[model samples]
Target: MINDSELILNADGSIYHLNLKPEDIADTIIFVGDPDRVPEVSKYFDDIEIRKGKREFITHTGHVNGKRLTVISTGIGTDNIDIVLNELDALLNFDFETRNLKSEIKSLDIIRIGTSGSIQGNIAMGTILASEYAIGFDTLMQYYQKPYNSKELEIQEAVIEKFHDLTFKPYVAHASERLLKKFAHDIPKGVTMTAPGFYGPQGRNLRSQNTYPHLIKQANTFKVNGYQITNLEMETAGIYALSNMLGHHAISINAILASRVNETFASNPKEIVDKAIRMVLDRL
Candidate 1:
């Protein structure tokens, strides 16, 4: 059995999975999927103090515009978000030495900067799309037992009923409005659709049998009230869900590098990503 004592670290010791101690992180965090992007993001930090990595997870803690922040790579998908978000919460809210809770909880502000495909035709290449809400098509939420908004649940139920032929259950959640406001002008805002995979899960071409053949069309045309599905990504739903549950403010900004319907990729993907990152830094 894994004991709490064993799971917990010494006050000055680092976390088991992230290899990071409390002092290694700041209250503001930027999450990316590429390990290399950790350095790419941290390069803009005014004064970087710590850098660490394990497997696909790389971290750098520093100051940007006088604000202390940590840039971490969560690899890809909600499963990785499960690990990173939980560990980050523990690092901030738990007493590492005693394996007990702290009197006051520290809520971190998280922003995910990643690449995604545009679902809407008008959302062009090199554009940055911020997620106002994320529709999760993953199973991570089955583990949680909590109350959700009634209107959101109704929308999710309708979506599931509409796509009953598909294999997975639909999950939906919204990003933090506070974070959205903070980064609003930094990137174009839209509703981001989160899927399970880049291929079959997202209605892409495959050699074998596939699921949700009309998913792209359904997602693209589907709108909740007037909000349209603007982009497709893998991690935003999980980030929104976990961040909401943990009382952290979180948002995702996707650089539109691909258009699934048109089979086109941004000619200058790096330039687009760099521009998005620079805008985010300036806003921070």
Candidate 2:
């Protein structure tokens, strides 16, 4: 039996951080980074059943076209992704009363619908792109025992070689082939670079100076085995990495809201995100 500290549950028996019980979610889940966007996705649901939240995590479970779906917000960053994924897996595969793992594990289909900035000019603003692979420039994966395949290792090695002077190492993770084929096969697919922050880590210099001034330029030119860093975002790599580790199928569908290459931002960011949301919902 797992100890209380290891598998912490609420007084009501829901998961600690997510404030969600096993029955509160669906097998197919959509993840949004912003809490406000939680309703944006859930609005399309035919009917919403359960709504729960705590901190930056807000969850809405419902159905659309007779298909059950759940949309939850992870706030931002891979750090939140760590908590969200683990707790979600626990809800699905752990017996909360027993505080133990179930005999049969269940894998959830996780789809991330979020906004991003295109690093490449060809990927215009308002375009919907799917991340076939994501390279994390964060330290979240370092704490996990991640095993990479030959393709993933090659990409990781290439990133390490490029950013050799960096203090920490980067990790590579791919989207689930099943989910990718199911939801994003027809769309433009490329590599996404998941930064730790919006400003410096993403090469954005507002009032502060960036250590790597040419970071975005370098990312635009980066490529390995035909996969280039196409866009910059904050969550896909974490989502993909943790999903892979937890035996869940995951994919990130990005609505391009900014263009680093063109130096432009979407005039109607909500409309862009809405289009992506509808596409995913229709596909789902």
Candidate 3:
């Protein structure tokens, strides 16, 4: 049985942060970073069924061609992802009435559609990157055991060798090949680095100084077994790692909005995001 400390629910018995009951969500979930983007993605749904919002987390479930889908907003950053992923798993994997773990676990298909900065010069602005693997520069998964696999170890070792003095212990996790082939098989695949912050962690220095000024340059040049660090975002790693531990299939489709190599940003990034949404929905 899950303790009350770990399993806090609302008066109506919905999940705390997400404020959603199991019936409100679908097996296939698409996560966005912005709350308002919830409607943008659900607009294409054939029929609207459920819509709920609490804090930065918003959920909308609908159907297309008799197929049900759920689009949810996770706000931003891996911190929010930590809450989102765990709560989501709880909803499916636990017997809420008894507060006991379910004997038969349920697996969900989770896909993150968000914007990212291109670390590779040739990746181009306004392009979409399908994250075959997510490299977590953040330490969100450090508390958990068995976080790194063979592929992840090789990727991190390569980065360490390239930047001998680098301090971050990065972990890599691959996207679900089942979901990858379903949604992003034809697209260009690359590895994504998930930073802890928008600035210093991603090697972006404004008025504040960054300890590792060359972190971005070194990471972009990192490659192992033909996988290159293609872009940077803030949530994919946590999503991939947590999804693996929880037995869910996860993938991230990134819209390239910034060019870290040439220092260029997208002027009308919303258009790019829309394109990505349509692309993912088509596959879904």
How badly does each model clash, as a count of residue pairs?
Answer: 0, 0, 0
Model 3 Cα lDDT, one tens digit per residue, 1-284:
88988998999999899999988889999999999999999999999889899999999999977889999999989999999999999998888899999899999999899999999999888998799998888888778764567877887778768767756577778899998889887888899999989989899888987788999888877878898899999999999989988889999999999999999999999999999999999887
Compose the digit string of candidate 1's lDDT tens values, residues 1-284.
Answer: 33665465534478877889888999989999999888888998898899888889899999988899899999989999989999999998887767777889889999999999998888888888889878888888878753568756866877787677766677778878888888975567887888778788888876957756788888877766677779898999999888888889998989999998787998898888888788889888
Candidate 2 Cα outliers beyond 4 Å, as residue runs: none
lDDT of 2 by residue, 11-75 (tens): 99898999999999899999999999999999899999998899999999999999999999999
Model 3 residue-pair collision total:
0
Give the better candidate number (1 or 3) by TM-score: 3
Clashing pairs in 2: none
TM-scores for all candidates: the values are 0.94, 0.98, 0.97
Per-candidate Cα lDDT values, in order, are 0.84, 0.92, 0.90
- Backbone clashes in candidate 1 total 0
Name the better of 2 and 3 by lDDT. Answer: 2
Candidate whose TM-score is highest = 2
Q: For candidate 3, give the lDDT of residue 231.
A: 94
Ten-residue stretch with the least lDDT total in model 3? 143-152
